[model samples]
Target: MRTVESRNWYEKSFGEDYLLVYKHRNQHEADRFVQRVIEWLELPSGSRILDLCCGAGRHALGLANAGYRVTGVDLSSVLLQKAKEADSSGCVRWVEADMRALPQDGTLTNSFDAVVNLFTSFGYFETDREQLDVLKQIWMALKPGGRFVLDVLNAGYVQDHLVPFSQRKENGVVISESRVIQNGFVIKEIKVEEGGSRPRFYTERVKLYSPQDMENMLKETGFLLDVMSGSYDGEAYDERRSPRMIMLGHRNL
Candidate 1:
């Protein structure tokens, strides 16, 4: 069940301040990740791609630059505007919508060759059923032979390498973060402060799901589990030490 307080945390957390807090994330790194995805998936040059929860639209833009048809979707209007401004040529299609319900009822159904949910976009909801519903939506949004890439944190590694507190200075702002794993969810409370402006706090929560848990969800969603990679370099998944759990699933042809 979702709590009233937690219900809208995401809406509050992803705002103008978010751009400042995460300013270090750049297009170069995103382009590298996009290149890896292209080689790993062996996707055609003009394949259609849906970048779900695409904050700032870097990866989506990279795919579009590579001659792929891309649609980037995110709930934050603030980030969407940044994405639109970055697209000077206006190549990629940007849509502001929640991941749970990607807009356009029948228009987007079976409309994509591949869907990429990157950087721990999964596990925002408080319930398992709600999270599974997202997978169902992705499954329905793909063509019969389409592929799906779910990039998420490795729960085992997170638990093993849990950092309690951290601090960093970026762009004249001091950022402090306190992290804790409670009730099977990894929660981070971030505080950003400038010299004069008041400190702004944002909370991010991602539920920890095991590899078996992800497998079960994909199987239930009707996606044929294909590969599970631990790193963007295409190494095999090692639950205990891997930094990421990137699963590749296929829709039955």
Candidate 2:
């Protein structure tokens, strides 16, 4: 008898389909966001930055273009290939690695001046310990007085604004999504259908953690929470109204 293999949705969902689905996340917007990040970091130009889970190197390349040395790490080989193709200037270094085991070696320990994990990249792990482990790795990778910026969906806003079902057409493909909150996780079931082709199905599961939870976790991992913004524009965070929770933390000097 054959046993079914158990794999995480993240391992399979972030291939070519993901790129196509999220193609509209353009470089211009990424650059704009990076500008905000640069101002928030308040670090000198040319400081070393790591873009963890840097899918397609959008933000990574943006940071590189803005005069910072950037290393982009992601688990998706396909996305990394796209990032390489787009990185004509060779400004950003791309690495294929999991967030849970970042750098995967001692060569990069305490190397980066700032690390940015954007677009809700955290909370993929099944357990709280595993989720916290990712933060620990980020802490270990930063030098003393280094900074970190994490962008994630606001759990309160998500709970209030979640639509059960939505459908749209993009580039001749019909994309349908069904979302439900289960066991403190927002689970999305995506279906994509192209004309005269079999429909493809994908799942995305992200654990929901409140802003306070994030602050506590970062503090416990040796980061001093500095700023918590509601959006990319540097507005103050509001648990009841913020669309995104953008946290800035600093390692103790």
Candidate 3:
């Protein structure tokens, strides 16, 4: 008999391959996004910020460079290592923790002045209740009236514009991806081939939640939805057209 390992796709897919797959998400873009978030939050210079699901610490490092106290938490130790390498200044604190459990020894409760979860990091859980639990944890980690920014794929726009197949080559690696929508989730199958190495396969799936769904979740989780934008540039959200759904909310006092 063979032992079977049971884990979500996210647990296996976010290892070393993920770094190469997403290497194009550079610091310049993160800096720009952090600037927009700072402007939107209007918090003090030394405010403590939590970059939840802060893969590779791009945005967290950017925030630290901009003079905010930043703590970045991600589930991938491999990515966290990369983040630590990039953060030579030792400015941002990086922690390996799942978003569903960010208690951090009770120190994280009501700790952050602002929390930012960018790049469509939400909606990975298997159940709606679990997704809501993540939001509740975010709310608990924030101080009264503290702000949060969530950036996710616009469900309507993605439904309308999803590309079924795409291929690209980067740094001697050929990567191919196929996507499909099923049962309220966007599922992507990825294949990577480098030189004579055996091909690697990975799958990524995220629940496709509409803006209204997110709004209601925030409200139910004790956050006041303040603004919804279509992009990092702060354009208003359009259900049929927006490429990204960026939302700003505050912990209800």
Candidate 4:
């Protein structure tokens, strides 16, 4: 008998140390990236947008600052609180929830004009059914003709350029990351060492989905493909060279 693999790594992985681990993420860059996305997708001013898996509300706040109504949803309470604290003006609504099952209340279901799942937010589940359920949730959350931006790592690029191990020191901690591609998943083991504290380890595993794989999934989830880009600058997608596979699409009317 086949059973579902437990997929709680994400629930445990995102914590205070994650902020230090992803410290390189820049706000100016997020602003510019979302600006380009707005222009590329032609999202109207004040349109409702759902930032799925919007960790710390970077791009979500970016979109809100650009005059859009934004809802930032993430699973991490630590990150969500950070996002809320940063949003002193209450410009963005922060929701702590898993992507696989979004709020079904009138507040979210079929209420968004667009949805953005940035930073490889997809491909976390252990099975295809669970992954597809996330897409269905995203689809259900959008209004007809709502745009979606799914930014994910390019599988081919990662396979071709997999760095097996790396270590770095930042903010009084030693962070070591080990990467491997196994069982159609990109697995990352992160270890953090701090002063006088035992080393803490966290693991992140994302399914490796190629461009074609995304296309099929999106179509299956009732999304109509619009544009596929390699970068935030709107470069064309190339399987071998693109660092990111950014899929831009829309839910059918």
Candidate 5:
């Protein structure tokens, strides 16, 4: 149900070597995704938000700009550094830590009004239990009646449109891709060939979950289902056409 082993490719690949790739391309896309999450959560100003696995502070920084006290936690020092560089307001409090074993700083125990696990972040753990534990921890991190928002990929759609391999070049960067295999995991291998340099390759393998699987996990973690949307514009979830599986869950008071 979750990823295992020390297979976090982003920690090494997303640093100095590939920061430009992430900053220029992925960051902007992530910003657009965050905007959707913010709109869906609809929390009032001055809310405290915890962004679990806050890669490059996309949503975290955006939330801060929108007037939320944001604490972003991630395992990648390189990404966090980029996040810090892009973080001009100093409004984001970045912490380098694991999502499962959040630091016992006494600062995050039931401290946030909302927690966001965006960009298909829930399935990168080592095992099903570990993945569930991450959800449980998130449940524990929220105040009574707080909300959790997730932007997940539609596994079904991915399988339907499975592309064995592909490539594209942008901003002097050549990106290769591959995907196939399901239920157990979705292996997306992206190879970035930077112009005037050797090609660097990174693979991301994340466990895949169906809507039922996600619903069951959220219920097991004590979160009440709120709404499920297919896209960022508050569109209804359509299995055939939607580009993403965007859903929001709430922790009952």
Candidate 6:
């Protein structure tokens, strides 16, 4: 099975370097993203949830506060530490692990009622097989009747309005953005300006995926494709106009 060998640019870009910046400006947006998922899932109170790629435990803890028993998993120790610190209700369980291959015999194998791959966390793999492997891992972790919700970007729409380059800075950090023409992926170059220290820069890349491609992957993993929308508001997906693509699938019982 193909696995992601090293920590990708995101782990570094969003690690200790950019966490504060994200928390300051982008945190509310993250929360809003989770709220959208919660609404779409319509999960009940105390629902068993596994949040894959649960960064900083924002979504996982948010769901827990709403009364869901949430277990969050990620590969970043620093982010997971922040997650553990922010988990006050004891409702959220934080695990540091790879999403492609989870601890099956450990805490996560076939052990959740709902598995979430939110905020466009589905397409980081360098190849199609690796991406499929990640889906299979998610498939195995869910209970027979479990559900999986994915919030991903609409590649077609993104390419249409694709910004070739942009820049933004806040909270003592500056972010330069660019796109890779080869794959039409977005790359963000972040630089932190600290006193008496040289500026540091890290990069993050996310592949743009089509709805049909994602649905096929889910079906290949034995999940039944349930819903697909363009945005968080339950609108129809136009592929050319929608800013976001959100999909919900279920594992066969």
TM-score for all models, in order of appearance: 0.95, 0.96, 0.96, 0.96, 0.88, 0.89
Predicted structure 6, TM vs. truth: 0.89
Regions of candidate 2 where Cα sits further than 4 Å from its true position:
1-5
Best by TM-score: 3
Deviating ranges (above 4 Å) for candidate 1: 1-7
Collision count of model 4:
0
Please report, in order, the local distance difference test score of every candidate based on alpha carbons: 0.89, 0.89, 0.91, 0.91, 0.80, 0.78
Lowest lDDT block of 10, candidate 1: 1-10
Model 6, 95-192: lDDT tens digits are 88888888866578788888988776777767888889888988888889788888888888877887777666665556555555456566555555
RMSD of each: 2.8, 2.2, 2.0, 3.4, 3.8, 4.1
Runs in model 4 deviating more than 4 A are 1-7
lDDT of 4 by residue, 162-203 (tens): 999999999879999999999999999998999998888889
Quote model 4's TM-score. 0.96
User: Which 10-residue span in candidate 5 carries the lowest summed lDDT?
Assistant: 1-10
lDDT by residue for model 2 over 1-253, one digit each (tens)?
Answer: 3234377789889998897777778898888899999999988889999899999988999899888989999999999999999999899989899888876577568999999999989989899899889898888888999999999989999999999999888898998999999999999988889999888878899999987798888888889998899998888999979999999988886
Provide the lowest-lDDT 10-residue window in model 6.
Answer: 1-10
lDDT score at residue 6, model 4, on the 0-100 scale: 62
Instruction: Give the RMSD in angstroms, all C-alphas superposed, for model 6.
Output: 4.1
